[model samples]
Target: MKLYTYFRSSAAYRVRIALNLKGLSYDAIPVHLTRTGGEHRQEGYTAINPAALVPALVDETRVLTQSMAIIEYLDETHPEPALLPGSALDRARIRAIAQAIACDIHPINNLRVLQYLGRELGASEEQKNAWYRHWVELGLQAVEAMLADDARTGAFCHGDTPTLADCCLVPQVFNARRFNCRMEAFPTINRIVDRCEAMEPFRLAAPSNQADAE
Candidate 1:
């Protein structure tokens, strides 16, 4: 297996964590997202993933895209230490939390959107970061409420073990801290993230630990 990844990309980070948790070793093909007009936008990577996104996984003849889809694929293919474990209702709850971060929170603050805010729309750096912080704080507040209210919430998002939700949560929290978003209000989130960061899988998959990290 080969993974085309950008070290700082949160989506890539999530996939890396899942791969680590599954104990699946793959060749890490670094695709620089910001150097020389972005390698992901160039012909070489576009040919592999027409979307030109980082973190495209090639397993033998199969090519997988999208962080969530790739994660679910890994969970399906490698069932041990199930990332989306539990009953149907439980899975739905887990997915809800993951989507709350990936779909709702991440899309608005990802690199492309931030670049568009500056390059295309002519927004200042302060405005772009403000936009990132606003969405992240609002979204995480809801996630905090969700986790705090749920009886199923344990050391991780869904239960004691890390799930798809935790994978999504850790990366988002990393970004939040990077942007200096105030975290004092989200105790559940902080506690869970602390537990995750202490583990080798999460630590090994951190952006700073990636081979291509600058």
Candidate 2:
């Protein structure tokens, strides 16, 4: 198996954590996202993933894209330590939490989106950062409320075991810290991230631990 990744991509980071949790080893193919106007944009990468996204997983000859789909595939293929919870409602809740960060927060502030805001929309760096922080804080606040309101949230996001929510949360926290987003209000997020960081899998899969880390 092989995993193509970018060092700081939160989407890729989520996949990294999922792969580690499953105890799956793969060739770490580092795809430099920003070396020369983004490696993901190159034809070779686009052939693997027409979306031009980071984290395209190759097992045997099959290449899979999208972090959530890859994670579900991993869970299905390797069910020893399941990354999802039991029951339909529990699964829905876990997916909701993950998507709260992955869809709501991430897409709006992606590197390409930020670049578009600056180059096409005439947004300054300061404005762009503020825009990023705004969505992150808003989304995180909602997640905090959801967790605080629910009894299912434990050391991890979904019960005592780390599930898909935890997988998504830790990477978003990494991105939050990188962008200097204030984390004081989101105590649950910080706690989960701390728990995840203590594990070797999360530690080794960190952006700084990557081969192409700057």
Candidate 3:
């Protein structure tokens, strides 16, 4: 297996964490997102993923795109240490949390969105950063309520073990900290992310530890 990834992409980071948790080894083929007009936009990468997104996984049989879809594929194929280990209701809850970050929060703050803000909208750096912080804080505050209010949340997002939710949460937290977003307001999120960061898989999957980290 080969993972076409960018070091700082939160979507790619989530897939890296999932692969690590599954004890799977794959070649990390770095695709620089910003250098040379973004490598992902090049023909070679577009041939693999027309969406021109980072973190496209190519295995023996197929190539996969979308971090969440790739994660679910991994979970289904490698069920041990299950990423969504629980009943139907529990699985739904876990997916909800993952989507809350992957879908709601991340899309608004993605690199493309930020670049558009500055390039097309003529927004200043301060304005762009403010845009990132506002949405992240608002989304995370809602996530905090979801986790703190639910008794299902434990050492990780779903239970004692890390699940799909934790995989999504850690990357978002990394991005939040990168932008200097105040995290103190979300105690539950902070606690869960701290626990995840202490583990070997999460630590290994960190952006700083990646080969392409700049």
Candidate number with greatest lDDT: 1
Candidate 3: stretches off by over 4 Å: none
TM-score of 2: 0.98
Screening candidate 1 with a backbone cut-off below 3 angstroms (N, C-alpha, C), the clashing residue pairs are none
Worst 10 residues of 3 by lDDT: 53-62
Q: In lDDT terms, how accurate is model 2?
A: 0.89
Q: Rank the candidates by TM-score, best first.
A: 3, 1, 2
lDDT tens readout by residue for model 2, 1-214: 8999988988888889888988999888888888899888999899999999989999999999999999999999999688886899999999999999889888898999999999999999899989999999999999998888899889889898889888888888888888999999998888888998999888888899988899
Task: Give residue 97's error in model 3 in angstroms.
Answer: 0.3
After TM-score superposition, the amount by which residue 69's alpha carbon in candidate 3 deviates from its true location, in angstroms, is: 0.5
Tell me model 1's lDDT, rounded to 2 decimals.
Answer: 0.96
Q: What is the TM-score of each candidate against the true structure?
A: 0.99, 0.98, 0.99
Error of 3 at 176 (Å): 0.2
Q: Write the per-residue lDDT of candidate 3 for residues 83-202, one digit (tens) a residue.
A: 999999999999999999999899999999999999999999999999999999999998999999999999999999999999999999999999999999999999999999999999
CA error at residue 176 for candidate 2, angstroms? 0.8
User: Worst lDDT window (10 residues) for model 1?
Assistant: 53-62
Pick by lDDT: 1 or 3, better one: 1
Model 1 lDDT tens row, 1-214: 8999998999999999999999999999999998998999999999999999978999998899999999999999999899999999999999999999999999999899999999999999899989999999999999999999999999999999999999999999999999999999999999999999999999999999999999
